[model samples]
Target: MGRYTMKSVSLNRLPIGSGLPKICIPIVAHTQEEVMKTAVQVVRSPADLVEWRLDFFDSLSPETVLETATELRQMLHGLPLLATFRSHREGGQQQTDDSAGIRIYHCLMDRQLAEAVDLELSQPADIRRSILSLARQTDTKVVMSYHDFRRTPSQKTIEGILGKMAAEQADIAKIAVMPQTPADVLRLLSATVSARSRLNIPVVTMAMGPLGKLSRISGSLTGSAITFGILDHASAPGQIEAGLLKNFLDELTVDQ
Candidate 1:
């Protein structure tokens, strides 16, 4: 456990990443009030951070997006935000093409509402670096992410993705995969251990779906620093609710 020195990030003054239970509540609202109310629920759920899935913004015009982002940031007050535009190809709501992906990525980063932004690791280095640079303009951290929808990749592949993230100066590296069997879960867990042992940057790793549920619970032990949860609808296809996530993690961390 000493390997992971959980640090705190002050968001307008609220603290994040303080070795405490981080309930990352996902948001999927279209209206300003809807999104704002959801943020309120996030506080009610006692989440450590809020992750706004921008792909869910149905009526989100650029102007509206900026306006909503401003309003959401204000309503959030001090809580840190992690805004993401996960491409549908990567299991997100936005079914965007390459050019469109780049556009949305840049647009979101330019606003600087989020304390951190999640960018697809598969994106070209230039694109990734560009968005990351925008983050720097606002002193935001970049969360480079990789998601394997079809199946889990080999341990070596996972490590490579993490290495790339580090090389790109990512603040956090996240990897998620769908496990077809129990053994797949083991590979993911082992990868987490390997990454933690060799790298210093924080990571968020998980194996999705029913077969991979155990990984979610044992994740903290394996070196996953954050957990993903949804109170109502999941931004991603398969995820447990906040209460369920809290329950599972609680049981896993119980005095063993």
Candidate 2:
């Protein structure tokens, strides 16, 4: 619905960035049992995709993670899965070394456990490139992301970050920042609109916290290809329930 020059990526035949923004739900649980339970709920929710916050897992071992992911893949009944290992610095629950995290990513992509993977842009350039290479070889979509939990940067800064992600050859670019004021939320949306118009790849941007909740449901107008919604728990601040968020997106799309 966004009036932007962009390319769309297919996840199980669902074309992101081609029409209404797709809704994604996050599954954050510590144990496999809890994870499966959450997955069941996500399957019933009005979500176009599901993101597994690997950092929330009690075990980060490659074998355990792969086994768990395999089970989750089957549980979703073909829902697109996005594997994310958010660093603690990026508001993730767990802290992991870059080497170990990359290993886990390799496992996921090699086996095609997830359709898309999120790599932090803040990671070393070489590390990111290596992951991008593997992702390409495995036909996995790479979503390069950056997060600022403190404050929303100037619109120029936000746009620059998104540009960097595109230059990195990301299939998708995402940024999440905390807004200290209503004006900060506007700054975030302004940046999203600019990046969405200029970038060839899809972009996802949002301002976190109560003051920034409006941006979550404003993707259609701002050119964001995807919006994160909550299923059992919210991985980020200001995430509304998946069903409610779907209703909001539908209404907004209709009005537009």
Candidate 3:
């Protein structure tokens, strides 16, 4: 797990901070057929990690989700897995209730279904505590996240949320916000820079939509732990593809 102090924590034994290409592709399918298709795409592409967006599955049933997890595990083999059931507040399916949502999440964690899991920051502290605590028991890395669809907050508020994650022992601090203007984007990036420099956790910061798209590819430049890309398919509204992102990162690579 990442702490408020720089200490190495392995993700499925994959040593991070080595300037390696770590890709996280979102799975936006329902049936086993589509899931398998995405799995094949990952094998053929440069994706370093597979994130099963559980909420995206159309015919998404609990049993089917479990079976798909098992199958995907076999297909993915050693690659790290990320299971996320993002709530409606954070740009995801609004089909599930809070109780059901919490239950399903715990179920996935209990099954040891993935190497990592994504949990929203807006959730109650008791719920967050329970989930993270349970993840620790399974040695599952937790990516505590926050997404702002309205506007970006000041660096102080950003730091406050990230600090809470640090206190909660989050493996990764991921924050995405919607930007209305150029200044909004800067605010988000500035906040990222501060959190990256002071906080002792790997930070993944991005600004969504066209106005905030710059941060998506420039994450690594500003101390972001991960930069998202569409390895095979797009998860969010505005996302660059993996091949294009690799080229972008290569040209922008600054040798310190």
> Against the true structure, whose lDDT is highest?
2
Candidate 3 residue-wise lDDT, 95-174, digit = tens: 67656566766777789888888888888989898989999998889889998888888878887888888888998888
Stretches of candidate 2 off by over 4 Å are 1-6, 254-256
Residue 99 lDDT, candidate 1, scale 0-100: 64
> Which of candidates 2 and 3 is the stronger one according to TM-score?
2
Give candidate 1 regions above 4 Å deviation.
1-3, 6-21, 98-108, 254-256
C-alpha displacement of 235 in model 2, angstroms?
Answer: 0.6
Candidate 2 on 70-138: residue-level lDDT in tens?
Answer: 999999998999999998889888666777678899999999999999999999989999999999999
Clashing pairs in 1: none
TM-score ranking, high to low: 2, 3, 1
Residue 145's lDDT within candidate 1 is: 94
Which residue runs of candidate 3 sit more than 4 Å off their true CA positions?
1-8, 17-21
